[model samples]
Target: MHFTRPRDLVVAGLVALAFVYVAFKFAYGSMPRLPTLAGATLIVLAVIEALLAFSIRARIRQRRVTSALAVVRAVALAKASSMLGALMLGAWLGVLAALLPRVGDLAAATGDVRSALVGTPSAIVLIAAGLWLEYCCRTPEGGDRKHDDHPTG
Candidate 1:
């Protein structure tokens, strides 16, 4: 199913807004041991990517050029966004991985294996969510490939 430009824009806007809100909350809220700095950085990057994706989608809808320029641009933006998302996910996972060992140590000290395992899902979920978002942003519309194959008259 094809999504309209307005719908894409709305979705991107909402995503960006949500990220901005989360970043703000992370930066200002009082949460002990929270990955506030990393969260804020990831949110900011996501906001930029969502906006770029929205812009590329808008340009593609215009159909002003039939030389596959729009497709190329969209693909480039999507790749960039995907890379950033991956980087953010990796950084988040790294933080969690680092903390996990410490938590494991604490857990061992207290004989609490469950507590150590509890945070494992946090990393897993973060990676999964990042992959989902990357997939969503990277999946180009069907027409994009057709445009790439067609010669510009």
Candidate 2:
């Protein structure tokens, strides 16, 4: 598969943001208070991906015989994580947009605002880590070559 495109991520995020904003607008009052640290889970994933990127890059640069399957798996993880991050970023932005004006009027909105603030940066970090991992997966020859190391392909 080709590299994940920024345009695709942006479109996905915008679509998710619009959908979430409308839905939350009607249901927010009935919803329970959001956990401030729930979004922070994404940050853990970002850290893992970043570590993987560093390890993979080191292996590639040292001309070690990295496994083709492992590299492909990393690429797949990176692609999925990036897409997830975009959607999450959109969702958090939607929450922020919906709750910001009401923060002064509602007590819960204030806490939810904190949640959104935490989530936005967590999602951004995930996206960055995913992109870095994807970049690290590229071959020394600039990734133009397919998985020539693969036994079957």
Candidate 3:
């Protein structure tokens, strides 16, 4: 599968930002308070992906035969995680934009601001870890190139 492109993530993020911001602008009063640690789950997932990347890279560097299925799964997971991170980042940014101005005037906005603060950084870490995991899935130099052994002379 092809590597995940940054442009795609950016587009996804921008779209989510616009949509979320508009939605929140109108409905924020009706919404409940956001949990301060709402993004903690993303951070946990990022840590797991980082650990997996290190293990996979070590196996590749040692010339150990890593399972093809495992590598494919890792790539898929990386791709999905990165996209999720982008969406979440955009979402948090949207919420922040809507709440930051009101933090001083509204009591609820204050708590939501804290949630956005935690979520934004967590999303960023997840994106980095996902990219790292994808990079680790690559084969080392000269490791799996096809042989040009066909007779043409």
What C-alpha lDDT, on a 0 to 100 scale, does residue 28 get in candidate 3?
89
Which parts of model 1 are misplaced by more than 4 Å?
A: 1-35, 65-74, 101-141, 144-153
lDDT of 3 by residue, 1-153 (tens): 467889989998998888889888889888998999998899999999999999998988897854878988999999999999999999999999988888898899998989999999999999999999988987889443335424244
Q: Which stretches of candidate 2 lie above 4 Å from their native place?
A: 145-153
Clashing pairs in 2: none
Worst 10 residues of 2 by lDDT: 144-153
Tens digit of per-residue lDDT, candidate 1, span 47-71:
5555655654555456444555554
**Candidate 2 lDDT for residue 79:** 95
Pick by TM-score: 2 or 3, better one: 2
Worst ten in a row by lDDT for model 3: 143-152
Best by TM-score: 2
Per-residue lDDT tens digits for candidate 2, residues 1-153, read 777889989998998899879877889888888899989999999999999999998898888845889989999999999999999999999999998998899899999999999999999999999999999988887654454533334
Score every model by TM-score. Answer: 0.39, 0.91, 0.90
